[model samples]
Target chain A: MAEQPPESARTLIEVVPALGEVAPLRPGDPVRVVIRFPLGHYRVPLYLRGKTGTVERLVTPAIDNEEEGFGRNAGDRRYYYRIVFPMTEIWTDYAGPPHDNLRIEVFETWLESARHA
Target chain B: MHEHGPGESRPHDEITETGPPDYFDVLETALEELLTERNLIRPGEVRHQIDVLDSRTPALGAKVIARAWVDAEFRARLLADGRGTCEELGITFYDDTGLIVLENTATVHNLVVCTLCSCYPRPVLGLPPDWYKQKPYRARAVVEPRALLAEFGTIIPDEVEIRVTDSTSALRFLVLPRRPEGTDDFTEEQLAALVTRDAMIGVVPVTAGKDGSGA
Candidate 1:
């Protein structure tokens, strides 16, 4: 499910339903970015699809940017999670040391619970 | 090494007048003029907004960093709540976007990037450099940050972890670089002058010279 996006990427940003209000995710919880490339205005980078990471923080809930990108629903609030992925996990041939990592803010809809090793 | 002072025009600034206008440029002009014509926005509002944006510079962020370096209480407040702490210093937020200050320490170095879009801390730092908005830096910053940073002459030791922060949501990030050594007696203003835009962006580290300007 973590396959990379095709080179000839087409634009198909779908303004889907925002995730419903649920239990808040806490720091250190394992989560993976949902792997689905619809080609539209997605904030989740292609490199992170299906890759698991630990939650760094539960940032303040904000309006969903996917809908806002299409100038549609602007008031629908969605939680944004700060997830941190180690460089080794992100790139198979990560040249840097194992200590390097990347943290990014992903909306609730783009994430799913993952099993912790 | 040269700096562009306020009112000194850059090459891109004169694009509309000199270079051929692109599709987005035409769209921007049309929207701006239409807003004025329709009385939705005042004639001078656009220019005023531009002036406001231009007024914000890295110096504003530098002040925040220097203050944090010298003052412990302010540093705690800034780490806990970046937006509120910045507003306390009179740094205005023109948009709904929020700011997050990522502190760099001996063990960890922080770098900020917006992989999806060029979302930046514009209120504190005037504008992002052209290279920041390009695809190479955006893509490689997250994938191979060490190599990308090395090109900028910032060689992070293996012991020190490199953490790249991607600004995907409304939150914008600004790196608070560690104060260089031997500046213990330097005044706050002197320390502020040492802070650079690239350092704040996490591309470079701040260094002090032997000129005794600060000490």
Candidate 2:
């Protein structure tokens, strides 16, 4: 059989699904939802870390930055997928408008099921 | 080695003799000093690799979004590898960053904000608008995205989930908003018409109203 020529030098790339490969919660499944921010280690937004909420949707699978060689560079390039709690659930006095929500897309590594759960 | 007064006017000649260094002078001096001391982010031939952000072309990511709107496989690739796929569309992200491109599908919505400092992806999406840079928008968007979106005229139904994307890195985001209806076989420019600065930022959906062109 004629050997197929070496693959073209073109770069291989793909968009990560909002959440990459995380098994979705069956409507009633329990999850520790959280907001994720993308930045260098020197600065992580104070409001988001370690806070807990629930996942709203699992849209699709995507590239995992951890496996990608970018390192923090990986973190810098793209964001992880997530949509955590509603506004009321996150804040006690979020009195700006009616039924506001703060859903976010976060990387998988940032999440861990709450011990309380 | 020159200096300028704090709030005093000086002629160009006087200033050149004793004023703050322009970029060229500073670069020359700094490079000489660095070579004399230590070599770092080297200041050699300085082949100015200009990664020109399309200040005139609006947010280039919008075009990618529009393409995803019409092409299913391309959309899948976008969802799979946003930065890589963007490269195919000639949207090369800056080094020291991995990009995440989120789709604003019919069932979902996306919005972006920078709460800490204005860390945006200037490589592909140009600069953030004044509103996006304001402290109010930054602090509040992550706290109350829906309310903020409403202020921008995007009223998401309770049934549909809204996802807020906060770009903390100088890593910018561009929303691939669900394509509007009645645009089958739309030309790239026509499709581009549906891509707006607001849509890319996720402040609002693309529309052909007011400007009668884009969202």
Strongest candidate by TM-score: 1
Highest DockQ: which candidate?
1
Backbone clashes in model 1, listed as residue pairs: A12-A39, A12-A40, A13-A40
Q: What is the C-alpha lDDT of each candidate?
A: 0.86, 0.61
Q: Per-residue CA lDDT of candidate 2, range B39-130, in tens?
A: 54443223222324333246477678777877889989987777788889877664555566767766678787777678665666777788
TM-score for each predicted model, relative to the true structure: 0.85, 0.62
RMSD of each: 10.7, 9.8
lDDT of 1 by residue, B78-191 (tens): 998898999999998998888888999999999998888798899998899999999999988998888899999999999999999989888999899999998999999999
Off by over 4 Å in 1: A1-19, B1-28
Q: Residue B208 CA error for candidate 1 (Å)?
A: 0.9
